[model samples]
Target chain A: MNDLRTKLMEAARSHSPSDAVPIGFEKQVMAQVLALKSTRQPGLLRAPVDAWALWTRTFLRATWSGLGVVMILSLGSLAVPPSDGDDSDYQGLMVDSIAMPIDETGGEIL
Target chain B: MSLLPEPSAVPSDLELVHAVRSGETERFEELICRYQARLFVMARRYARREDEVEDIVQEILLKAYTRLETWRGDAPFEHWLMRLGTRICYDFLRQHQRSREITSTELSGDEVDWMECQALPDGRADGKADAARTLVARVLDRLSPASRLVITLLELEDKSVKEVAALTGWSVPVIKVRAFRARLEMKRLIERLDREKYL
Candidate 1:
């Protein structure tokens, strides 16, 4: 069994080394290398976004979204009339105050 | 006293490495041209397809170029590049193993006959050599990537366990274990082939 194993291994090892490099393989490699070099951004300037950067970006995005929601809510409140039934008196008072004419002549004692 | 080396003398790999590190990027092409054939041959041992072989060679060259600074002048540049190449091959094998299953088809009668002929002492000729190489490749395809690599390095390339360890970043004991497993796997594969051929 050992001899057969050795013989098999010898047969396997006897397989000739393949030196048949495809034509233009070096040129292809050089082209790829050059392309990679050209496409590669400088490490310092274009390093991959780290955890800190990603966190900051996410935080900023969330903050901006929250601000947008707040702005929309504020604008929505301003556009819609107050729905509280108890504020009817205050609303009437506001209308009356706006309707009151401004005195154009010298102020008279009230 | 003459301060300069002879003009006719070839620059050593270390000298070229220094030139490359010193901003002589074009000189890298010289290194590439010098080592491309060797790297291709090494890649071929691990890669069955031509495209894969090219990819391995290209990757090795790109890595060696980008990491030139890491190469201390302790060993010959060729040896260093070879180590890098071997590691890349191992990685490729591992990746391939993960992505695919290894299945062995039974050898046909003609193929078995060819294998028998090649097994003879004097049957190694031009066409037969190619066939034998293919047969060996097919047999190797049935092994796990690690086993295949171990057998290829130990049996085919005649590398020692220590050498494989250094090349693969595996410990000596690990290499020994893998080699043993690889040999057993190979023996089983051969036995199966022998049965198919005779029965």
Candidate 2:
């Protein structure tokens, strides 16, 4: 197996494609480069070229999400009971706050 | 007066790259003319069809052009370009791996004879190098993409493990491991071919 492997490697080393580069290959590559240059932004300028597009996309997404959150909050607020002009609720809250326990150090006990 | 023209100093690859980056795009052709033949030779090893080789070369060149900025000047430009070329060739191998099947019908009579010649006592097959090459290519086809890449680099290209690791971005130990498995895979492929031929 080792000998066969050596022979195979020898053959591979000896074998190379005799064909040269196809004629006009350089022209084809040059043409491609030229076309690419026309479309592709230079490295220095690419970031700026994409900046506006990226900003527009980000801004639009943020606007939609903000509106969505607002809509959800508005709908949620509608589900909650509205408070009447009554001092009773405030009076009960004030009593609860006064009745809460406090330690000597002024930290609330858990 | 002698008819011979004066020898002019050619621009270096780094200089040409700088020129292209500085908006002198035409200078890129100098780089292409300098390296295209070498790239074609490398691509030919991975792809048999001339058209496929051409496409691979084109892709490599275009990629080099687009990513030219990423090439730090610490290394030689040829090394950078060849590394890119090797990676593209590996990708081409993987992309075409599914379509490149090694069937019995693919081998020619000479290739079969070459395979049989291996079992002989002397194991000499003169004037059948092409057949050996074909057989090797077939066996390589049977290997997985990573195996094929490792074998091609280690054996066919005569690259050292360190060099292969550098070109492939694989660590030295990984290249060593892959090369060992690749050789084993090649041996199994050749044995299978011989068995099928006998049966």
Candidate 3:
């Protein structure tokens, strides 16, 4: 019984193409792989070209820009004149003296 | 990305994947060369057109390489590839079966009869093992994707049920039941073949 089946299997496998790789299959796949390799990301997350470097440089540029603004504000404040316009309402009252009549003296309290 | 690492230094698929992740492209190719035949055979059995088989094999290889990061390395890489190819083929077959029209008679008569009885043993005259394998491959080809895979992994590849489940993303109980049904189906198919003149 077993002999019968074995013969059949041998016949089947003999005709079967077990390892018939197509001509240039490796080259074709490798070509695609080369293209694939070019598309690979540089990190775990695919960062765009100059993403991090550009961001850091922009940040530093903005920081200096902010410092310039601060310096300009300080210099502008220093260049302004001090307060010169004073109120004169209380100036005349500062020296005004009130005299009580001398008690029964000094020309009869005139 | 890192350059492809040395093959001799990599001990496992996981290590190879890590190396690829680190930017070693050759490691990926190493993987492809090693398993391409297996995947191609499995895919060919499913695809009707030779072109379709080649496309599916390339597609699977590309997908496998691209998604190697997703591989958990918990199961054998070959089993994982088998699972991928089987699923793809199943989807393809199911789609074609729905859309295509074929005469029942043609389906049965187009192929020549398989003379399973004539196969002789080279050294071991007891042909039990080899005969059984031929019978099994035929039966396997007829089975549903889920059912066929259980036997392919557990019987042919010597994977445990747990390993099969892990590779297939199926539960152990599901794998076991499918395996049982697949075995029954194989027996029935063999008996039917026996009735035909091929045996």
CA error at residue A17 for candidate 1, angstroms: 2.1
Q: Number of clashes in every candidate structure?
A: 0, 0, 12
Ordered by TM-score, highest first, the candidates read: 2, 1, 3
* Model 2 regions more than 4 Å off: A42-110, B1-8, B99-105
| RMSD to true structure for each model, in Å | 13.1, 11.8, 18.8
Evaluated at residue A62, the lDDT of candidate 1 is 100
TM-scores for all candidates: the values are: 0.66, 0.75, 0.49
Of the true interface contacts, the fraction found in model 2 is 0.51
Docking category of candidate 1? incorrect
Best by lDDT: 2
Q: How far out, in Å, is residue A26 in model 3?
A: 3.4
Model 3, range B34-135, lDDT digits (tens) per residue?
777777676655554678778877777776766666666677777777777766766665554431222223222212223332333433334344444444
lDDT of each: 0.74, 0.85, 0.61
Write out the backbone clash pairs for model 2: none
Highest DockQ scorer: 2
Q: For each candidate, what's the DockQ?
A: 0.16, 0.29, 0.05
Tell me the lDDT of model 3 at A64. 100
